[model samples]
Target: MPQLQSHTIRYANPILPGFYPDPSIVRAEDYFYLVCSSFEYFPGVPIFRSRDLIHWEQIGNVLDRISQLDLTDQKNSDGIYAPALRYHEGTFYMITTAVRGIGNFYVTATNPAGPWSDPIRIPYGGIDPSLFFDDDGKVYVTAQQGADYNSHAIQYEIDITTGEALSEPQVVWHGDGGPWTEGPHLYKINGLYYMMSASGGTAKEHREIIGRSDRPYGPFERYPDPILTHRHLNHPIQYLGHADLVEDHHGEWWAVFLGVRLTKDRYSVLGRETFLAPVVWNDGWPHIDNNEGTVSLDMAVQRLPLTAPSTPENHAAIVLGRDDFNEELGPQWLFVRNPSDRACSLTEKPGFLTLYGEETGLGEVGQITFVGRRQQHLHASFTACMSFIPVSDGEEAGLCIRRDEDAHYELGVRRSGGRNVIFARLTVRRESLIVYENETKAEQLLLHIESTEKEYKLACSEDGQNWLSLGSGSARAISPEDFVHKMCFTGAVVGLYATGNGQASKTPARFDWFEYEI
Candidate 1:
């Protein structure tokens, strides 16, 4: 991965890296703020602020509290969906549908960082809700109610304070009769109300289309062709669509959307990332990627003074790197659901992160003891130095590369029979299989997984240098396409985990350091 300096005049594409999808962005004066969907991952709706569109810094997460979001009964990949970010007057409003927890809601805050309002459930149906503030002091909420080509979008005026409908929901357009018409955003430019949306399912044929109307609703004239896409692009960027447009301080039009890096065999394990491309308006219709209809790894745009804002080392430093557990956990770390302060601790054992070994979960019915971060690269290696001793046959602690609970691979050290051993397990939905096992004499072990675009290779080492291959599995086995029971919407993650099978354990697994590399 080529690195870009924060102070560089020119920046690279994918200004926002990792699994950031369904981007809703806006420019407030010289600053730009963006938000993305978090799915079932906790601390949902990650919010980022950028002085220029190039260097974005994650300020905070919207649903950072349990009272604001509840995903207890939600299945894997069934939580927060697309979110729309908008700033009006002195308020910043974030509107979206929490797919499984709550239906439609919006949160607000004056400052992007703290004390965001809890979910204000709006009496709306469907997913991917967006908010648009018209010049006439009217606020509109729009959403897609159907799936695939049957999907139709409707908009209604809403009172932002109480989430109350001010007008009846009305269907504006059917979106060019495209497959999976969704992700609608409204913008008024040149006295015309334009509705930009994503059509075609979020797979290979995804595209961004634009339609305009004289009024806020009804009889929108949809452009015959998509404004942005990469279905035919030979570049590494794929799954392109779901765009939001904004104008910079220099009056230059820009569009931010989501796209995945196509690795080997067109496999994308890092998930959808936010990409930046210039928008050129041609006879009132905006063009993306410099009017080239596609985006690439690098983009050309005007710099924003390149103000030196102390940022993390790199993309890997922000989302894909080593953790010595010396300081507080940053925004990169995530938990399954609502977490407590007792879940992960560094002060418990000096520099090591001690995860309290949770009692076993029977058939995904109990709490899981783990802390993970999203896998944000096509080829990634995650290694951890862990020391744990199982109290009983059920206790285990090791590394796991998970897509969801339904599909995942785990390599852990546990006590089986009478001797301590290392095991590799592959699970699809509820079915589990022990792919590899070996007796070990190491008390403190180095557990790792070399994840590539097409395969996941499990490896272990008694010491950091002497590595042993445990087993290998297809990368698709842990992808959204491999779910056996139901469909999946989230990407893969690698983390440290400890569980006691079904029984309670007071022991904790200590991890000295966790490192990641390309």
Candidate 2:
């Protein structure tokens, strides 16, 4: 890609779409680097780089190594929480909490793209941790202390080089009586310290609030109202909060936050996406989006020299639009938890991706032979050319749109009544039903999953010319609102999956190519 001319641009909100939430951004070397929270997904903390804040390109993930994270048997939305990225001096630091695993930890890398140091554990017992480097060569860690409505921001001094707590944790700022006072970020501007946090939970009442004081801790004055929110607004975008501020090369302030676009039924399946808005400093307090107070689908702002991302040629960055599986799997691909080496391969079959069926299925905590990418758009098309032969009745391989383990829709090929059949199965809340099935004689099949705002249409074809509709699954069924006791923090992901149901299979499914388009 070439560099975009520096000029004012008209762009849409949610600059980086899909389940990218709790975004933290920093400007280094005239470039902006960002990281987002990835829960229960392997290769955690997806990171991106941009010359202009309006446009971003995924460079790599922050937690790509297994040693940095372990999400084994972790439930949906229960792995890596809000991650804060900061560039201090010459090293880049990323700190986060590993729910159901480590309490809190930080990683260091000279380069933001790769080879981060093994997680250095922080003895803190809270989520959404952030590191603030002060002018006096001092670093402080600020995070949320309790859970839900009882949560409050806590701060402690830490030696950034050794990850050692130099001071005891102390209350910094209790929120404005919101349900969840989390996602704390500390910054110093014009000699005064500013503490920002998201409150009122992360759903309908989500809003960003800020407070300021002359010192890093204590006696802070809160801005009277939320800096940003869409709580009671009649708009398509809702659930807005959890923001990080950045100053561009043009000396303009901006904020990157998380917000969701809802369907007609007011259900969000694409998860909380990253949105950008201009920030203004008024009387020492920051205001979001020129006092509009809420973010929208479209945003026109003055950009700082719009420049297209020039990703390094050697970097295995995600290529937008389609993937032919010609090279190694890009950084955008993800597995359920800690994946086994035997689960998938790109070298087993040249120019193809091979998935060996594992004994575990999607609904189980066991590692399944599955590989997928985030469903970044509400209306998108995903198709894969797969050659799978099921030898047993329970062995199957095909495409799946997974919100979690219990809630997903699978379109696969299985052996039924001594014949090969293409089936569409809908499983929600541990209940499975084969909604549609058709007998097929083809050895190689092209599986397609077309998603609208309300439904997902599964279809199949042998020649890639003639297609047959198998069935459709309701989009609302996989949404967060449909859950009873379960949580839905992560958004929907569509990808290729293979399973043996109970017993391991000798057969392997080969996918020639997988393409996802918006």
Candidate 3:
């Protein structure tokens, strides 16, 4: 493949930031399309499109309908895994694993943004599934199998139309001796089959390794060392791996992978993000990010001319930090697990989000009444105005800074001691504590949560003008570094929630507006 080396342009490392991990990219003509894992959040597998590789705008979600996605009772970081997005013969196919839902499946759509077909289940038992279409019209599927050191890449021939197995699955390649060989992407470049897979887990030891073979399923030759990694480097961006390669219109090669930005204490609250790096080929193998073998936050690289959308309709209107509840929720909003239609409504009160408290709370595994957007910046502010009348002690509705079920902070209005009060509660490792509580006589409350790199400061106001400072919580308490083994693959989400501890709430919580800023 030819490489572009005209002039260098400066761009940020993580083109798509905040919890967008296990990235897969493909060039479908002049546009480059990318998809990422959504985990337990509904509307899984967010898709983005860009004329230039660096800037991306979310077009829509692949799994938008409830009938297509069954994330019922899925725990945090367990719904949608690594999705391999590929465009073949006028159709865009996304194959992935729904860890606790339907195992392996692939969905198709003629247009990148629209109503995608229902998932066609693949009768396979593994994560990070990918589909490859050969020039001879043959289809192949690759996935990771086994465990730990025994982990390796597996492939099989299948009919893309019906998801039928045409050939028995075969082990194609074992990684470069790294454990947990997963997120495999198979490509036929220059008449040679290349298999790229991530290994050494998804932590600081993560790296991308490759191998090649003459046939689709064969005894492949390993690449000896990782093509892309920051495993031992003292860089701000760590845990780089699970990459997908694409050839641009100008015959330039580029890679989009997952990496995390760490604080001074090596803690990352932003989770794994999607990053871009230039790729060059020598002889037959590929090298990523030049000879430095690592990528940084600010990179000067050669890329295609930036082509931003000219019209307002074509432009991605992702809200930066504020939502006025004037229209239906946008693509950036997410719901925990598979939420019911009765959980939230926009037309009930008109200009207000009405959340009905279900028996299930955030601490449980079942679906709760909540809607959130990913915390994109380390230093950001999230504020919401809610009018909730809690008649019972367990009924509450307010703002939440959530990392997961067990790791979250809630600031809301609830009935305590037969009176309404504003409260701040923190839950870590299944232990819950009410840190601050004060009686509030106002019917409407404005809750605010300010996040710094080190900690999160919470405050509230009854009149939406004067604020009363609630206590703060350490950001490290919600960081993924402490709970990687417990499947903490998601970042913090600032959300509005209404939940009844063990019973259904009689009155609904009406949120007039919510805002977030960095």
Candidate 4:
């Protein structure tokens, strides 16, 4: 086999930020296809492609049209969990779980970069879904299924031509040693079928486990121990689990899994993030990076050949941290649920994007109806200029650093009494929207959020000068557990938004410019 001379982890600075979790990858010809979990964000399952895994570009999303999936009455962080992307017989398929309305749905496209078909619901009950096509064209699906509170590893044989299960699903394994075991991928190599899954809970202690079976559906046997884990790191950010395996052109294998790095206090506000490690087969089993069950911050081997260098410049083009909503939402932006064209309008505002206040507050409406990008990096500045007039009291518009509706820091203008007030609020959910009043007053406000490795400080300025500190609150950096939902999938996007008390007929906010720098 032709071997890649060098393989290195390039693009360590988050290819996609904010809430992109459980990435599944496939290669076609010279380009590599990748997809990530969108959660409540609409236009769910962003699809990206790369000639070299180091430089990725967003082509489109798998779930673009609302008819493609169900997002009616969905809440924040409540839809579309983990998605798996695969290609076979000149067609690309993405199977995902729509947690709220549809259970597991599959969409297909002639091209990985696509005009994908509407989601066809699979009667199977599961969360993280994976698809496999065998050499003889036998199709199968593996997922985490069980009762509402308990989970079991299940698999079913299916007909690929029609997304129908040929056999009833059977529980091949149950999560015992670990709290929850899910996200399974079945790969066949050298007549051996391998099952890789995420075990433990999706928290700081998550890990990836491996099992094997000669048949697609069988009495699979788990390796005596975990193939990869974060158990050794002293109070390390939750590690291991939620993994997908792929082999490059040269026949070298690698695994892309989610993990997190923590700040001093063991906080990972950013959520779980994607990490890569080399996979080597040993004694009829697979191990990570030279038979070591764990990965180090640095590796000395290559899984793929490195490309030649291009022309040098003052700096790499500022690929991340900039957005022109003129086009479709960049990979950096995320919504609470699947998005629709009608939820927002760049055409109505022209040169600006307008997000109409939905009936649901930031806590609900996870779809494209209430979209927010992620906040990554320790030291960064988020600024946005918007123009809006609140219609009634309790209506607000401006910038926010959000986890869910309950946990966030927002600085905006609200209709308090009859006057517009500049206010800042910390949301801890079920508790009061902790309000902080700014001494300086203004009708229209320019919102700014700044963060260091420790805390977040929010401020506002009228003429871009003489800033007033609305308030300062503690901030946590990104880690594997939080990385899944904290940051936007593409990258941290500093954008504009508007939300009201849900009583007004309609409230609109216009954003002039949104900028972020690290």
Candidate 5:
């Protein structure tokens, strides 16, 4: 494989923005499809398509119907974790972890931009489920499993058509010298089965580890050591790993992985984001560019001609915050937990989306409620204006950027003392609202948030003019975990939301507009 001329590692400025994580990419015909893990967000696993890897557009979602995915009792960032996307024999398959119930499930579709089928539950217990189809048509799925600290890397020969485990999963490797091991992928090259996974933790200590086996079922051998590791750095950036391998049409190899950028002290609030790196073969072994384990923020490489662009500048880009909800909801927006199609309406009107307030109260923590998109990029602002006649005391219509129940900022119109008042509330879980204020006549409040490389400032304006500073909030990027996950793949979305006790007639909030600026 001939390598392109050396260039700086250029990141396509946030292709999806907002909370998209653990990206899985597959090439289908002239288009490349990407899917990301959407935890607790309804319409799970948004599917995006790109003609060039740099430019991506949201097609639809794989888990639109509640029956398609299980999210019962799952909290924010806890339902679906890492998802694997692959096309085998005319069927596009997505395997993922449904953390709340039914462990792992596989969904299939004929079209990458799909009318996907309901999930076919695969009786397996693991996160980061991946599918690998061999030349013989043998389908295999790999995942990380262990009761506690003792975990093993495992894979199972699967029935591609039925999504069933054909045989018991066998342990291929264990984290002997490595720290918390997870995110496993299998590939075959030159008669050798290559297994790549992330080890160390999901922090700055992450590294990409490689193992190889002559057979599908591995008596696998670990590479002399990790093919890529950042363990050598004294004060390392949180490079904790989750990786996927991709090859271009030219047969050149590349790996897409997730890492975090730290800000002030030990805070990494941006969430784990996807990164690309070159891979080279050394004496039948795989090694990342220099095998240093950590991908450099300054490193640059020309994208393979066949690799789809993953940036917003691309034509296929999915624009969030600005909704003409008539078309499909772009991959950026997500509903809390498993969203009920009946809860909201899009596609009915050409440019309008109406959201009916669900029974869940916005104040309740961890409730299967609220639809939101991720907040991507540091210096981006989202604005949405809605008009609603509150039906009850709790009914509120507003805009919010939420990470979990505990951490979020909300600006909306709420009825108080039999009158509508503009209000802003910041909740950092268990703690009381950090900031709360009510304006007497805030006819239309444009909630503006500006995030810099270090901090975030929140402001509101009346008539979308003369912005008033509402004080700034301390923002710190955190790693993706059961609670806080890195914001990668998907950028933040600004749109309409309504919550509280009310019928559609009383709670209907007509969104005027939503805008996002980066």
Candidate 6:
């Protein structure tokens, strides 16, 4: 346990912005590593590295290959959950659960940027799995059990190499019971074991609670109140829980956690972003946010003497650069579920991304030839310059903004009645609507979704300069609950897509560039 003293070097909130939820961090000597869940997206958990917590670079993904993870039959937002990243001895361990298919698993690597080992499935039947290495050389695994989202957790010592339980699985601790006590992490401070868990749901009311025990698995004593929360603050950033504490090389403690950026109306498009806060040791327990017990938009910390990677930013927000298809895919690019080799390719054309139109469309239970990146900002403009000549009326190519499979809005271009036309389509679960349409003849056009804080305006441009408004809709229609009738843990993603309705179309949709900005 360590205390923090305020210093210079200002940094904006959300060290890692956009759809990076359930954050867990660990420090090893001079470097700090963090990982976040990927849900149904391929490349299960994204990993980052930094000398200072303010600036981070994506080194690699924990599950980047089909062998590491497979979300083949996963539901809309049901894939990987919370991950615990820790460094012990000379090995780095990442323990988590792939919800739909394989249950709990742990992967290891000597370097954070991997070539990580294949999934080592743990037979334990729980989610949000975490691990703690004790000074006695024994390791313990903790996870949330029971069927409901409000289920408590259980703990047991286990062998990380063999996945064998050294002791019987025992119900260890239940948090300050508001709801689900999940996202467990254990630490030893001053010879006392401190356990942390998240509760009160992962919505606006999310919170973090701490407890103490003499040993890893024990009858722990719960803290009287939440150590960190934004529940009653009436701020735009809510759902502040699921955190991991790490000590810096300076012996100062800091916390990295997940929080959503809610709009004025409390609707979130950036599902949950990773945020950092300073920690101070009170007696023995780590007290975050001084005595105020609330994480703010900005924090003061010790500035490490290290250079940060250049980040693209304007006064509005961070900018995701245009993908011109002149190089390989960036780390931000992702597919709906596990992507097929036939879905898309960059080498087919020198400066274009050729998306082979698939039969399955968005929000379907099957895979599609859609690749997207997480929509990071609320008020943003997303445009894709695409060229596709539909052989049949069923073939189409366009820009899509998806909440999940069941909930999404698409502004598409297709061949209709021997004429090229643009159409606006919206789907909320079983309900679907083609809200607007207009005729166009250009083989290459720019499809645009200009999103305000409250609404989205769909339009197109013959050239990148002149724009035509297709239609506009309220942002609430495409939120989590509207798509799948559940609180979707994921967020919205925007990118280019192509489909043949339900038939195979060998004619590919080529995208010259895809730009998303705030």
Using lDDT as the measure, which candidate wins? 3
- Candidate 5 per-residue lDDT, tens place, 334-436, comes to 7777555556666544465666676665545333336566666656777665656674676777777655555666677777677776767765542536365
Per-residue lDDT tens digits of candidate 3, residues 279-335? 878889998842254588878876664454343432242357568898999888989
Per-residue lDDT of model 1, residues 99-208, tens digit only: 76779999899888868998888886589888988888898998888887789788899888898998889887688777888888888988999998898888788888
lDDT-based ranking? 3, 2, 6, 1, 4, 5
Name the best candidate (by TM-score). 3
lDDT of 2 by residue, 334-413 (tens): 98887788888889888899988788988888778889998887888999999988778778899999988878998979
Clashing pairs in 2: none
Candidate 4, residue 455: CA error in Å? 1.8
**Model 5 lDDT on a 0 to 1 scale:** 0.66
lDDT of each: 0.79, 0.85, 0.86, 0.68, 0.66, 0.80
Query: Against the hidden true structure, what lDDT does model 2 obtain?
Result: 0.85
User: Residue-pair clashes per candidate, as listed?
Assistant: 3, 0, 1, 37, 42, 1
| Segments in model 5 whose C-alpha atoms lie over 4 Å from true places | 1-18, 234-237, 289-294, 302-304, 307-321, 324-328, 346-352, 363-369, 439-443, 477-495, 501-505
Positional deviation of 86 in candidate 5, in angstroms?
1.9
Q: Which is superior by TM-score, 4 or 5?
A: 4
| Candidate numbers, best TM-score first, in rank order | 3, 2, 6, 1, 4, 5
- For candidate 6, the lDDT comes to 0.80
Q: Positional deviation of 426 in candidate 6, in angstroms?
A: 2.3
